[model samples]
Target: MGEVIRVAVVGKGGSGKSTVAGTLSRLVARQGRKTLALDSDPMPGLALSLGLGHITEPMLTAAVEKDLNGRWQLKKGIGGARAVSQFSIEGPDGVRFLQFGKADELGLGTMFASVSGFGQVVHRIAEDGVLSDWSIIGDLSAGTRQTAYDWAPYADTYLVVVEPTWKSVLTGRRIVRLAEQRGAEHIHLIANKIESNGDLDVIEERMDLAARCVISRDPMVTTADAAGVALIDHAPESSAVASIASLAEGLEGD
Candidate 1:
């Protein structure tokens, strides 16, 4: 409703959530909209997927500290979200990339602490309008489990990516419910890997999916992943990239 909007790409593991989030943000940025892309997944890959290579610093370790009680706390109080902009890495197509946290050899405890602490970061930016001046897109962690950490409040709109698989549909359905329960302003389904028109029909039969856009399976995505480049840059003419760009173009002036 303002100059900026927050959109989150969420789904089960291997649903191409990062791909959709990365390319969609790129397109949005190319349309002259200032955009910031945040990777909230513990195992983040949006940087490489977005053609920005890898970001070495994770958001958790970047903004938090351990207290004497051995509890993780925000190092900078409520200003943490605003500070994220100061340190964001430059991403392709004018979109800045930030991270929630990444765990390389870190144990689950540290990862969960990041999860909990990042909930504060998300809530700060989401509701406080810290990032409201720019189009904020988040690549959320796999599964609906993020809802447990109060993460659903971060997005005004939820783009649930569903592959043409039974497990994907079931998981997407759960995500839809969680998004609704958390009071998301809008919920849209984006169907991926649509090899044929029947795939949409099959998905529709299993669930009432009002798909916002159907992205067909394109090998360019695989090629881009293999070569470590953004598909928008590697294969701009690819059907997948073109369709997603069109979708982002429509959002201009909204």
Candidate 2:
């Protein structure tokens, strides 16, 4: 792996994918890498985990314009680098954040332009050579829709987060299969919320794939959630954050 690791964190909802994505982004930035944390959930999950609570605005809406064919694009000169400098929000540890807008009471209809803008931006980042050395961490929406629709073109590696529950295992397996089908270079299972060796065993046995890393089920995670802050901010020395830090190190150092 190079200094820049483009990763998409995918899994079932509530399986702790956001936690892993947010923490890993901050840790990588702390290692002196330019890290961009992306939230394409449209449900305001990743922002809360990244400690940028309740970012409801459609940040990408201004960066895009309709072409002669009425197709949305990144304007005339707006590429990945410019988009980050202009639209992304800065968070703790110098990690930049970009997000697709949250759905209002009118459903996704309200932020349709932002959603289209986000799609174009991600694909542009993957294709553009300008940000070759910047790390990109994307937290995809829950379940298989985004994975099936090719939402994460920038991710050469897909980290499928799985819990001990059977549902989470099934979703993780489906995501792995989807990534393989798309010719992903690397796909790793990240066993999350592990309470013991038995939990890890059960996850691996059920998924039939060994995890590259395991994040322990720590009370600090719950504490951080209750406090509405990032895990790194709430308890940097906790077991869960330590595991995530190790995951970041292993990925970036590879």
RMSDs, each prediction? 2.5, 1.9
Clash number for candidate 2: 1
TM-score of each: 0.89, 0.94
**Candidate 2 on 1-254: residue-level lDDT in tens?**
33889999999999999999999988888888888998998666777788787776678888877779977777888887888889999988889999977876225543777888888888888887667788999999999889999999989999999999989998989998899998888898899989889999999998888999999889999989888888888898999999987888788655
Pairs of colliding residues, candidate 1? none
Q: CA lDDT of 248 in candidate 2?
A: 83
In terms of lDDT, model 2 sits at 0.87
Top candidate on lDDT is 2
How does residue 185 of candidate 2 score in lDDT?
89
- Point out the worst 10-residue segment of candidate 1 by lDDT: 245-254
Kindly report the root-mean-square deviation of model 2 from the true structure over all alpha carbons.
1.9
Winner by TM-score: 2
Error at 189, model 2, angstroms? 1.0
lDDT value, residue 130 of candidate 2: 64
